[model samples]
Target: MTRFDIPAPDAAAHAAALERLDALVKPVGALGRLEELAAWLCAASGQVPPPPIERPRVVVFAGDHGVSRLSAYPREVTAAMVRVFLAGKSGVNVLAREVGAGVRVLDIAVDDDLSDVPAEVRAWKVRRGSGSIEAEDALEPGEAARAFEAGRRVADAEVDDGADLLIPGDMGIGNTAVAAALVAAALGVPAEEVVGTGTGVDEAGRARKVAVVRAAVERAGERVSDPFELLTALGSACAAATAGFLVQGAVRGVPVVLDGVFSAAAAVVAAEIAPEAVRWWLAGHRSTEPSQAVALKALGLTPIVDLGLRLGEGSGAVQAIPTLRAARAIIADMGLLADLG
Candidate 1:
């Protein structure tokens, strides 16, 4: 049971940012969502006309689920994708490059040895793979706490090293199922409503995923009221880690851009752990997954964009970085109407 001392965003700064946006040369309310983004930035950073997003960082938590048979892809794909991310060849890499954000991949619970890979990548691993949620707890007795601490350490390190904005990504086969189950348990929703065609699962695959989510949710039962207990019962090491990363990011007063359903599900758990942390997060995009919208609604967050993005590896959030930069620039560089007079 980790306690997070997350401070609420600066209300005065938010008001000052809105005043500045209204005083801009453009007509009032002309910038639409951009104005909202600028104000959020001000509140998150606790500064009027917040500093530039110079060093955005993406942390991809890679793992494997014992219930990955429900996924369209094999569990080995998680490790393979981690390698691709490390090689700077994934979709997130391309998008992160476009936004000048550095990417780091951690093997939180990959089933593979990854012996040849860099040691730093596997430094935070909790286990080979999480247990199958439908039949067993996702983590052992204390593994969930360890994984959560690993995520918090990662966020603290990134923020200490000058990461201005954080994007927590996911890389795990069958993680969508894990995410859906977690969200269903958190929101008391039916599995059918939370389940989606993750990784292009066929109709049969989706049905199987829904069944697995239902079973996991049922198994979780009363644990849904306790964030850590819910994560241990239904979430992978990656999910728990992501939840911790998000919470620590807000605790450190760093703004985060959440990715798809995977991140969104973790966010629901994070919000449960620290309700004030929601103010430091921005929904980067609306994922095609229905569970994402449900989780976002629970958090009272509106997505900045809706490009139908379902890719999970922080691709959607990375793509939205430019828009965040534009928002910051509008506040920092735009001429004020009062200046003209």
Candidate 2:
């Protein structure tokens, strides 16, 4: 029952950005989506031409879902990947380095001891693993609130540390199934439509995933109308935290770049909690996950790029950071046509 007061982005700044883009020494609308991106940054940051993205931080929320059977990989992979991320060996690390963004992985609900890990990563641990959604609620009473508050704190910490842009990533085995179930319940969509070949699941695995999603959504039932309830019923701790992180980013007036299906699913829940927060978010890329498309459509956001990226962990969002930088540069550094005289 945590509430967020998320104000909409600056409309006058958006208008001014559009005008400046039009006045640039280039054909109107020539920059295509880049122009749109520049305007969005201006609006979100309340600047006619937003400042350069000096520090983009990606926070990977790692967890382990009890419904491990739905994924091609076992549940332990979540913790292993968290270690890889911490070691700067994950795909997100490489891409984040390429884009000048820092990566931080948190163990939100990974079903592991992780006591030996750094305290910062395990500081927000909610539980070992969320309950199996198909048969039980994802979180116990009060756990959702804890996870959500953890996300909000993380957002504040990152912003205070000078993170100009935030990318929320996900790392959990069987998380795609959890996200699919959440999306189906939130959007009233069929499980088959939301389920995808997450973690390279085979056709049989996908069928089983769809069944799991259908059952979880059906179990959620009317609770889907309530964002927190829906998250507790069908979402994981990492997901709840991601939703909180996104909403807090808007509350703090910081822009967020959403990753793949997991991030998109969290975004749906975040939107329900604070509709105006959507204005501070941007779709970094089009994930091949069908549920991602459905969620993005619901949010009325067009992906900045579509490289067929299905990898989670903020890889796709990091890939789009350069493009975001270019968009800001175009607005900040491009010469005005009026200056030609």
Best by lDDT: 1
lDDT of each: 0.92, 0.91
User: Against the true structure, candidate 1 has what lDDT?
Assistant: 0.92
- Reference-based lDDT, residue 157, model 2: 98
What tens digits encode model 2's per-residue C-alpha lDDT throughout 252-282?
9999999999999999998998888898899
User: In angstroms, how far off is 71's CA in candidate 2?
Assistant: 1.2
lDDT tens string, model 1, 35-107?
A: 9999999988889899989999999999999889987788899889988998999999988998899999999
Q: Against the correct fold, how does model 2 do in TM-score?
A: 0.97
Q: Give the TM-score of candidate 1.
A: 0.98
